[model samples]
Target chain A: MAELTYIEAINSALREELARDRGVYVIGEDVALGGPFGATKGLAAEFGERRVVNTPISEGAIMGLATGAAAMGLRPVIEVMFVDFITLAMDQLVNHAAKLHYMSGGQLGIPLTVRVQQGAAGNGGAQHSQSLEAWFIHVPGLKVVMPSNPADAKGLLTAAIRDDSPVICIEHRALYWTRGEVPDGEHTIPIGRAALRRPGKDVTLVATSRMVEVALEVAGTLANEGIEVEVIDPRSLLPLDLDTITASLRKTGRLVIAHEAVEGAGFGAELLAQVQEAAFDYLDAPIARVGAPFAPVPASPVLEQAFVPGAERLAGAVRKVVLGA
Target chain B: MTSELNQQEAMELLRTMLLIRRFEEGLIQTQKSGISIGHFHVYIGQECTGAAAIALLEPQDKIATTHRNHGHLLARGADPRRLYAEILGKAAGYNKGKGGTLHATVAGLGFLSTSALVGGAVPLAVGAGFAAKQLGERCVSVGFFGDGVLEEGVFFESLNMASLWKLPVVFMCENNSAGALGQSAGEYPGSTIATKQLIDVVAPFGVPASAVDGGDPRAVRDVTQQALARARNGGGPTFIEARTVRWPGSRPLWPELSTGETDVAFAWEPDRIPMAHRDWFANDGLIRYVRQLFDAKLANTKEILALDATVRADLAKAMRFAIEAPYPDPASALDDVFA
Candidate 1:
């Protein structure tokens, strides 16, 4: 095993999948030219232009191409430059790819993977900064994945490439440089299984994306105050591991969900609802949620910080829900 | 090359056009009966467009279309019953009742898929064409849309990309004079960029194009056959504009549609439909002589409807299954989202 950054792990997994399957290929704007984030650097040099295609600046065309290719028995890994721009291709993702198999009486299989970078980190601002995973999670027949760590990112992405459906794997711009030990050789992670990073009995803290880091930080701080909080990173939001979350809630009788998206209808709220519906009898307090306010993520660093949930706000929510203060 | 299609083939083509026309009329009546609910745009006068286009396609070729899709869906061999069930919102419908009237899909028949959004299906068809090219398959992806959708940027971008890559696709524009609310006058800058201008726009892209009379199946078939044969033989994309008129009042119009007082023959009504629609429907001198054509088409349609009954019953069974089917275990609502 070697320590790799989230971006490196994702690129490595993409490379491995491409090498492993002849049917697999990558397409997007600047994907052949090393991409906007350079995640696809040196890929075009190795795979040639046909495999690592550089397309015109048309998001809809790229996604629609991926869907059509998937329908035609090709495994296409499409990279949307920024998650914000994915809105422009929403028709392809929602109307075509996601609904193809179900609509085609199971005669068609859409083995397509869409990689997108989302969320606020370096003031990419209102347009560039968005956690639109919740939007895809709302649709049926789509797999919505956002990994909080390098290994999970690589593993989940590899799994997404092989899955026989449309999978949206979101990479955070903030998590790209964060390093972890990803399996050196070929590895695949099962989607829908939430990882229990730190187990405890006092309260269950569920988080996703960059917010998972905040929950882990808050777990440590709360531990010093004699509060044992379990931090659960829901690697995939759509096909969520409800059984594990419900079990955690059953053990702790308390739940605090967090994410970088707005509180109104973020994945956190969806997680909370699942736990509440399944383990409502075990609840000792109202579920606490830490999320950004419902507004366009601001451009200013300070305002962006205030707009999204951080370790401080997350810790406070845990304290309030756990210590009853 | 004219010998490629025999007398039987020609009759089959005419029969298919009649089926599409009758099926569309059925959908309109189904909508009228309140069984199907939604804003439906039926191709009442454009049956030849679908018949002729599909006649040019092979089994491996794929197709995509816009919201006004009942005719194309049926023309591509989709069962009228499951399609009817799809419109009925029954569980056993084509898309398991998920995609209603606007979004119908049949992968087995090579229809690939359809979408409700304008200009939505164009890029997908381009992508399918790209896939066909990549696989070294002798196939073409055909996309059908109205003149109103031509204004969309995705359509232009698709045209540019397909040519840039030399992908095999036929961009069939059914310029039926009027779109849902906009008239051809309001939709276009002027007749300067008429169907011929559309062909000219794609000429420089190295993609050969032409505009044909959409109401006449022979014209549509002749133009599409030349285009599809060229595409399969590795010639790049081709854009064909089928210049047809949607029977007036078939769809609601905006900025006020011309009243029927001046042109009663051009008006669309329930009883004054189908067989008599050509001469009686239009201001033509061949009104008395059209009886033979109408009688022949009527006999063929009656036979086709009889064959359609079994499929309709099967679809009805599927509909019963969907309606009586148990709802998702409220908990399973979140089941498929992640996995």
Candidate 2:
């Protein structure tokens, strides 16, 4: 095992996938220049220009081109710079890529992976900072994955590249520099499995992407107070591991869903509905959702800090469920 | 810039065009009888463009076409019975009834997909060409779209990338508005593009562009050959605007069989043609191709009539088979979503 940053793990995964499969190729804007956030660092030079291609600032064309290539027996891993910009390519992603295999009656298999970043990191403004994982998880054909750390990042990306379906790998920019222990060789995590950050028995705290960090921090603080908290990081949102969350709910009897997206009509709502449906009698208290307010991410750093839900907001929600304060 | 199509190949081209024409004629009739449901488009007026151009493609080459995709599919030798059943949403269809008329695609026949959305196939062809280049294959990819494709921003984006990357692709834009007073006949039902000439839109990209009479099979065949040759040689993409006169049948909001099934004899005996749709027959590319065949002594009236008769009989069988085909199992609707 080695300690690598989240971005380094992602870059390592791309390098390994390219080296492993001759059919695998990378295409995106500035991807040859190692991408906007260095997720593709040192990949273009390592794989050469043919395998790592750079396209113009055309999201729709990029998505459509990747879809076509994937259907034609090439495993294309495309980068869209940011999740917010994916709105431009939604037709190709939602209408074409998400529907091609089904529409073609199993004649076409799109083994495509789209890598994009989100979160209110560096006060990047509303256009770049918003988390849009909620939009993709709703798509049927797509498998949505959000890695919380370095190990999951490398493992999940490798799985996505090898999968037969089109997968969307959404990374949080704030966690790129965070250091974590990642396995040395050939690490792969299943698409729908949930990872338990901390095993406990009082409250089941569920989080996604960067919000997993907040859940862990709040759970650690609560641990010192003799309050046992179970932290569950649902790595893959689309093929959700509801059984794990429900199993934890059977013990904890309380649940709190946390994410960087808006609290209203976000992935939290979907999770809340499913959790209640599966384990309605397991609840000792009403579920609490910790997320940003229903508004665009602000430009100012201070406003952005207030806009994004952090450890304190999650801690408050945890305290409400446990301490009843 | 030459096509060495032998007499046999020439007859095969005519047979494919006839099949496309008869299949569409049957579809129009079926729609009229309120049997075939939903909104569907046809390739009645621009048969020569699809048949001649696709005739030049090898079996290994890839194609990305748009909504009016029946002709392209048939030209690639798609079985009419399955294609007919696909249009009728039957289990024996090409796409297992999942994709009806608009999205019917033959994956094994190099047509892995045909987008229902306008201009969606251009970028797909770019990717297909990219894959071919990566594999070091000499096969060229073709994007068959309408003139309305030029209105989409992705069309420009796709062309720019194909030229910059030297990707082997042919952007075949069928402009069936030669007599529509410059008004496009599809999507918005008018030419709303700001560019005066559609070919001029891709001029700044430095790629070679051509404008040919979409009616002339040999002329369309020659231009398509030139573009395909350039692509196969790694010379990059070529945009060919094949212009044909829009048939009166496609003029209204809903397609009507205004010109009727097609009369091959009108090419030889123009005086006997009906006056109401005379302009349509005069501008019809299929009729012009037949006259070219007659003038060159490549085929006689008896031979052409025999070919049409065979196509009609086959189409009649295919249509009956499709009409009697079963609808897909409702439980299998969720299948193929992942694979």
Candidate 3:
């Protein structure tokens, strides 16, 4: 294992996948030039211009192309640059790529992975900073995965490239520079399995994407306070690791879910509803959820940080669920 | 020489055209009889375009077509029994009733996706070409869409990328609109494109473009052959716009059998042809094909009638099979959501 930043881990995943499979290819607007965040840097040189393709700035068409290529047994990984711009390719991703397998009577397998980054930390304004993982999670045909750290950023993406179904791997912009040790080679984490970040007895905490790191921090602090908080990172959202989560809830008897997206009608709501159905009897206290407000992400760093849900809000929710305070 | 046809080729083309024409008409009749297929588009007037263009394609070549996709599939010899079953939403359908009339993809036959949304599958053809090129295969891919597809930005993007990357794909635009662009009597509703000529749209991308009389099977076949050759030779993508007058039976909304089930006798019986839909019959590609066969003596009127009878008989059995085909098990609806 080596210490690699989230962005470097992702780049490694692409390089490994491209090298591992002749059918695998990378396509996006600036993918030939390593894309906007440099996750695909030097890939074009390594894989040749054919495999690491740079496409025109037409998200709809580019997405359609990837979907078609995937249908023909080609594994295409597309970088949407930002999750916000994915709206332009919604038809291809949702209708074509997602539904093609079922619609074609199981004849086609869309082994396509769409990689997008979401977070409110960039102060890139409302258009660029919104965490839109909920929209993809709601889609029936798509497998949604969020990697909170460098290790998962590599593993989940590798699995997504190899999986038969279309997967949307939601990376966090803020986590790109965050460093963590990733396994050296051929590391693939199973999708739909939750990673246990910390084991505790007082309250169970489920966090997604960047919130996992935040939850770990809060759990660490709360541990010092003698209130043990369990942290579970649900790597995959669609095929949710409800089994691991309910087991955690069964042990702890209190739960709190956290994400960077808005609290209203977000992934938290879905997870909360599912958690209740599975572990309603086990819960000793009402579940708490910490998330951004309903407003669009602000451009100013002060307003953006204030608007985004962070450690303070998570700590309050954790304390509420664990201490009844 | 462009219109030259061998006896077997002419007979096969005529049979394919008749099968497509009869299948669509049979579907309309079924819908009218309260079977309720739900807002399906037909390749009524432009049968020749599909039959001719697709006939040139090898088994390895991929097809991604639009809403008017029945003809393209039928042209490639897709069983009418299964196709009918698919349209009727039955278990024996091409997609096992999952994809109905709108998205009838036959993956086994190299069809990628039959998208109902306009221009949705246009870029898919290019992607198939990209796959072929990357895999070092000499295969070609084809996209069959309508004139309205030109209005979509994806079409332009597809053309630009296909040209830039030298992807081997044929973009076949079936422009059924009559007169200039659109908005004339008996004209098919089409895109209000800024370019006077559809071929001119591709000039900026530097992809070669051509126009063929869609009614003429020979012309459609010839143009498609040229385009396919250009693509396979790594000469890049070729765009062909097949133009046809909107069939009179093809109405403003729901199509009608206004022409009363295309009589092959119209080929010889000029006086028997109705004057009201005269232009439709006169320009009818299938009918013109029959007339050309008679002139060339590829198949006499007697032989042609016999072929039509056989096609109808086959279709009759296919239709019955579709009608009798059961709906898939309700529990299976949850299946194939992934993979």
List, for all models, the DockQ compared with the true complex.
0.37, 0.83, 0.80
- Every prediction: chain A TM-score: 0.98, 0.98, 0.99
How large an RMSD does model 3 have?
A: 2.0
Task: Please write out the lDDT profile of model 1 over residues A1-325, one tens digit for every residue.
Answer: 9999988998899899889998888999999988877788888998888899888888887888888878888899999999999998888898888877766556578899999999898888899998888899988888988899999999999999999989999999999999999989997889889899999999999888898888888899999999999989989887888888888888998999988888888787787777777889989999998888989999999999889888888888888998798
Q: Candidate 2 on B1-339: residue-level lDDT in tens?
A: 114667788788889888998898999888899895577777887998999898888988999987789999999999999999998999999999998888899999998588988788888899999999999998799999888788788998899999999999999999876222346345332357777678888899988998898888878988899999999998999999998777767743356688777888888998777998888888887787788778878889999999999999999999999999999999989888786
lDDT of 1 by residue, B1-339 (tens): 123456466556655655555555555555555453566666666776887688767889998887778888888887766776766666557765655677777877777667777788888889889888888899899999877666677877788889888888999988776655545555442232344456676677677788877766656778898888878888878899887755654656111121121121123232454553444245321111122233444324344445345434554454445445443343522332322
| Interface RMSD, every prediction, one decimal place | 2.8, 0.8, 0.9
TM-score of chain B only, all predictions? 0.75, 0.94, 0.95
Q: List the residue pairs that clash in candidate 1.
A: A238-B337, A238-B338, A239-B337, A239-B338, A239-B339
Better of 1 and 2 by TM-score: 2
Docking class of 1: acceptable
**lDDT for each residue of candidate 3 in B1-339, tens digit (9 for 90 to 100):** 225667888888889999999999998888888898987777888999998888888988899997789999999879999999999999999999999998888988889999977788988888888888888888899998888888888888888889999899999999987222235543334557677789988988999999889998878878888999899899999999999877766664466688888889999897788888787788888888889888887889899999999999999899999999999998879989998
Q: Which scores better on TM-score, 1 or 3?
A: 3
Per-residue alpha-carbon lDDT of model 3 for A179-210, expressed as tens digits? 99999999999989989999999999999998
> Alpha-carbon error at B280 in model 3, in Å?
1.7
- Pull out the clashing pairs in model 2: B184-B191
Docking class of 2: high
How high is the lDDT of residue B63 in model 1? 89
Off by over 4 Å in 1: B1-5, B30-39, B89-100, B182-197, B200-206, B253-280, B283-339
